[model samples]
Target: MSNYRNHFMSHIKTTIGELLEKLEQHNWRHSVYVNEPEDTSIHTVCFVIDTDSAELENDVFTPSIAAQNGLREFLPVHDLQGVREYLANVGVSGTPEAELFAIMHYFKWDTYPSERELAAYQ
Candidate 1:
């Protein structure tokens, strides 16, 4: 991840954490978009403060979908860890560990945030 993105995510992480506290929301959802159409490394980490609605149950709140639906802006993160930490901070108490587990499960189940290897053909 570039330094600029790191800084950006850091800023948003703090802002979102504050938002989560102020909202005092228990239900939240997130979507990860790895390999963005525009830039592969530019993975998007999207979060929805409210997800109790039935319509959002099917991973409909993902980054791409959220952006398309005009629900929220696509927040970019450097890596899966960044996404996990952000979710942890925004989620209700004791949700960080759970968020990490769920994120890993989602990545495995959905095969997202595809790995990228850069090396010479040796």
Candidate 2:
């Protein structure tokens, strides 16, 4: 079982590395979020790759329409499709979201409610 797990993780890492390279080639900025739910009932890891880019438009900037929609059209269709299928087969799940709120909710940061109160305490 350990050998199988090692092989599975290795394959996933290799696939993600290849996909990141492809994204870089197209000059797209990307973020990868991985969540392993604390609930034992949920047996899969949630892997999301969010990508974005800006386009030059009449001296203004606009988001890439293709990327906004999804990677299907922005990237070669087969590239993303193959990755999705591979993940599904391995009992892993992959998804996309417009924002990173899902994973951000789990993060804790050291912040003060007001700068004045923090300065006084210091």
- Note the Cα lDDT for every prediction shown: 0.33, 0.28
The residue-by-residue lDDT of candidate 2 on 1-122, one tens digit each, is: 01122322211212233443333332123333233223211222222222333342353432233234322212232333444444445444333320111112222222212323223222
Candidate 1 residue lDDT tens string, 1-122: 11222321312222233332323322234222222323212123324322223234246643333445444432223334454554444542324334334345444454322222101100
Assess candidate 2 and give its TM-score to the true structure: 0.20
Where does candidate 2 stray beyond 4 Å? 1-74, 97-122
TM-score of each: 0.21, 0.20
For model 2, name the residue pairs that clash: none
Q: Give model 1's TM-score versus the native structure.
A: 0.21
Clashing pairs in 1: none
Deviating ranges (above 4 Å) for candidate 1 = 1-25, 28-43, 53-102, 110-122
RMSD of 2: 16.2
Scored by lDDT, model 2 comes in at: 0.28
Cα distance off (Å), candidate 2, residue 26: 20
Worst 10 residues of 1 by lDDT: 113-122
